[model samples]
Target: MVSRVELFALIRRDARVEGLSVRALADRHGVHRRTVRQALGSAVPPPRKTPARSSPVTGPLREAMDEILRADLDAPRKQRHTAHRIWERLVDEHDAEIAYRTVSKYVARRRPEILLEARNRAGVMDGFVPQTHLPGQDAEVDFAEVWVNVGGVDTKCFLFTLRMSFSGKAIHRVYSSQGQEAFFAGHVAAFTELGGVPAGEIRYDNLSSAVRRVCFGRSRVETEKWVLFKSAYGVTSFYCMPGKEGAHEKGGVEGEGGRFRRRWFVPVPKIADISGLAGINDRLAAADHAEDARHIDQRTATIGQDFALEAPLLAALPVDEFDIALTTTPRVDRYARITVRQALYSVPARLIGQTVRAKLDAEELVVLHGSAEVARHPRLTTKGGQHLVLDHYLEVLAGKPGALRGATALVHARQKGWFTATHDAFWAAARAKHGDQAGTRLLIEVLLLHRRMAHAHVIAGIRVTLEAGSVSPDVVAIEARKHAAAAGSTAGDVEVEPPGPQRSRSKVVSLPERRRDSDLPPDSRPAPSVAAYDQLLSNTPKKGNAS
Candidate 1:
């Protein structure tokens, strides 16, 4: 393979310098005489390394992949994957039947594929060389596979990422599930990570993310939104003909993605919280931009070094980030709440029965009834769970007893075991003595103790007394000697018990009287219509009912 310019030069050198005929020039170059003549007249030099058919042998994997490809050959190229990429995607996305290496070997053995990458033109390889970068002129984008366990179910998810070819900077964001929105959002986020849009061009595999039509030699079939997107950023998009051994197209970001997954996303990555995981990702992307890599562009020292040169040419940031976040239409249900993956989020009474958008990210959920942001909460991933909050739905508990069980986003209160088993026992004992309202108040006290020590220690101390059937969180607090900042060790495994079982029996001492039903407040909003409470004698803590 020779560049057209090279072919022309071959003829030129032979015809004028070496006294060779045009036919002889074509013979030496393995090109037609006309091609040789055409190359001679071209003003632009021919591309280096004219691509060629890579396949040499075929086997079972080849046969299998061929059948899959053959079935969809005429439909479109973008819709059907090229051989090499299809190989990677099969194993990466679907856990296909064969190894990716096998798919790659088989595709390479076929020489020319009608899918995956574009076909190479013969003779272009004779004197071909790759193009040099021009500062902020080009960027490459790619996808990486990440494994995550959302709740108890383990599954693989795709991460969309972008790497500036000149600067080495990359930006990435996760998708709960990948489809068009996730793919589009990745592009938006990558640009944001780069601080602005690159002025040159961005390269991508004709991923379903960017293209819909896959015509041969017709490499320009692109989606409307993507066309508009690139046009807005003021950059050109180039495509390789499908079924070609043309790794050179998006090679920069392609290799970058693999390097990044191995260095930053792999080995062992654990996150108890989603936001923390995102923070680590952002840090890694920023680090890649600053560290110089082995390959250096012509003008700039390295990709990171070149980024400074290119930054000035990129598009300006918009007023708001593309809320690439997903939103779902749901109504806060009858219980004054909206349910997410089984965990319920309480919205206000005014929004009840009205449809709202549950704008969701990997870590948080925001409920909006149209334009107004009504409520926000951490999104849960499991089914059949309760994250009930008393304050968010306090309107439901007015004048009712035992109606409120959960503390509000009191995770803010720095409370330990706000609704754990020990809390349950203490509540039971308190209700036996002072009624559910008193039990709720006692629950608040244990949480407040967290200001002095870790919540677990507070709960451990609570259990020591509450487990013995006691209502005095204060007495329990005193017995545990947690009067001051606890001297307990910080080891996560430490065991601390709540106060004593020393009982006060026999001659009854006076205690504060419990409120009667008529004593219920009159000014609060009426609760959701429901069954009435058991209204009976409640003037004092019933010692007979005491635990």
Candidate 2:
């Protein structure tokens, strides 16, 4: 089908080329004579005119609608009248008949004009100015929620993004939570990745991790730790205005988080544990580096090229790194556990009833006895959560074997895969041969072997003893040492000490040996000639006959 403009072109062309009369042109084009005359008058088609239509129902209600919309200027923005509400009011209060669609079309056209008039009267200006950032001068920081499959379970994670404003270069880190420690850890990680901090102020929202209180105007009450951290790094913080009003102040990072999540976390990354985040973060760093070669928006240079100009301008890192871990001294209870941030973490059993130093960081808790590290566990996210290490209670278990069965540390070990099925099998066999108490004690002795030997070696030793129908921990220790020695040398035989006096002296049966003939490679040489030896014997036999 031809458009109006096309139809007009066709009409004018036919009249010009064919020399057809206006009546014939109209008949050929299937149009009116007036249309052909108009086409002949001008090459362009005239705009279609819409005739004014009278609305008897809404004509009188216009005044009422205007009054309602005008009254909305003083009302709260959310509570103001809508088009439908205005129509309903007209129907209920004035007994006026008006279509909702008519009211809606009128309101849509008139409301913007009312707002413009009001803004002009109030002398208010609403517009955005183009922003320019100097190299390494400005950056934005923000946190966004990311979902990941951890241990086959969907888990919520917090993603921290720090983007350079000038180059659009960004560094990101993921955490279990957005707490103060995690916030500090993110900054540390980003700084390490970027190789320096921004010389100018970094923009941020009113996150509690940095600001203790959001004060009037731009003044903010910063947390004590945040102040110290800034001093350590020589950083300047620029807090954006509260809520959506300040969102545009740091638009770079606000958009970067979404882009990164969509780019990398689209499949909902799966990790066996929180430690898997290190691998994810490594991949993200590579991705960041790869992006440096790509352009951002209409920029002439690639991001990496721009970053090269900015990288050198950044402030140098401090000579001494800041220790971001929170230090606390907690007394160990009778259970040999220290409570830190409302979470229970096991230390050595000997530390019970004693005070120990605990350092809590974003990802882990380290317990210290004097200058030496005694215990370490992954940080707990929830209140009243407990992390127990089985080795911490080994000494206690040795004294009271009954406690091994019901020990919370043992349960935790099983959950963590630290305790294997081989251990359980050996324990059951030992308990059957020796009584429960003696067998459990023997298992505790074997468990102690892990401290001196590798875990796999100890497990192999247990298997060797169990196969030989021996329930002795000493035999397991001897076999475990043999495994350790065998691992050290592959081409030579391993020497193992004999079992202790308490163990049975019976020689353990061994597998059938290989044949000697089969052990040697095939020899291609013929049988050695004995002709020379025969000649010597004949020469000596004549002397024997004379004698």
Candidate 3:
């Protein structure tokens, strides 16, 4: 770790005074000859020529091993991990220099430790114990998997789970990753559902989120953050020992996750979107609590009934709910929504594309511009999902003369007899012609037409082609067009152009604004062009055909 500059100063002193050889200098310095030579080089060495430290996995073979691991980590195998097998694989597939014996040593050193594997627990007395607990005293937390639909796409999900030992009351939330923020948010949400933070020890299955160092036995050194959280709520957290053959120690909630999955997640919850998953899970956990369990140690009450009594021990909600999830500042997009977990969340149009802190939790995502709440939605569960709503960008749509989209609220703004029969076919055609983004935006603009017309007129015009009970954005636009012609305000409300002859493929030219260096202040970079455009439009007038 010694700096080369300091080493060079010593080398120069030795070279000037003692005239020591490079090897001698290296010996005196207790370093490599090459290092000593570099320090005392008469000619400067090119930075590119410097050699990095040596490791067992080096050069092409190391890269090959990395690629091999990445490519086949999930390959079907009983145990694809023995040193001989890995060595054979390398020789067969990648032409590696790796010896089978050396591979064994390497794998022994690098293989991640697995502590919890399923096995018989009948004879074991060291696993999770004291399952039947006094009401309001103990809770266990873990993670489980389920399937969910995001933006109409089905994907596997990771859910954090919490359960009360006495009442069998449980709660869980889904997240995209098992990172610190999600773990913290899970704790927050679980505690909230428990009605208060439990007063007794909080138990954990040796997850890295709560423990930093696993000791030799069933003990662990908690992380600074974990310690702080426990102290904040004054609950003792215990981590199960790593690699211990004890099942009973963490058996209660340890098996609960699998039980829940088998009972509930066999077929992933089929839903339209992630926004609906939170409510679904909330209801799902409630149903899970209705199960009946009768044990001698457990009181006469069922798990659900016992949990009801334990619920009272939880602390009351603080004046301000503690944001357990980590927060990073985010900016709104041209659509006036902040993207989190790949989903776009609608914030106020006034704050579109502006820098704001995003507090992410398992249950909900909150975007804030200073003290103002920009947007809130069920927290997303994927890295690349976009949560979009037209209303978040309404002001911006109203400002730009031809901004294609209107607010999401436009979906509801049909007037009576304003747009007439057979608009559905045209609307569907328009949407099909435009991309979803452009189509949704265009629909929002149609809804804005209701500003001048009565709601009944908007409905009437839209219903011309569809049933009276049915509503469509295209119908609203048709009604608005009729009223615009009669009022003479349509010409002024929007540009006189007639929507460019309704091209099948609506050409969207998104003008991205450049953020100069000046716009990037300390601790904050200039907002991206797309996000900025979203904000700019969100602040514009939304009542007219301006978008």
lDDT of each: 0.61, 0.86, 0.61
Off by over 4 Å in 3: 1-136, 149-153, 166-196, 206-229, 243-248, 292-301, 304-320, 325-327, 332-353, 370-372, 391-445, 449-461, 464-547
lDDT of 1 by residue, 212-251 (tens): 8887674657776666666655656766545445676677
lDDT of 2 by residue, 303-388 (tens): 88999999999999989989989999999999999998888999999999999999988888899999999998888877998999
Cα distance off (Å), candidate 3, residue 326: 4.3
Model 1 bad stretches (over 4 Å): 1-129, 148-155, 173-175, 179-185, 205-248, 293-300, 319-322, 326-329, 335-351, 361-363, 369-374, 377-418, 428-547
For residues 481-527, write the lDDT of model 3, one tens digit per residue: 55444444443344323333323312212233223345754547665
Candidate number that wins on lDDT, 1 or 2: 2
- Candidates 1 and 2 compared: the better one by TM-score is 2
TM-score ranking from best candidate downward:
2, 1, 3
What are the clash counts of all predictions, listed in order?
Answer: 40, 1, 56
Model 3 residue 493 CA deviation (Å) reads 19
Best by TM-score: 2
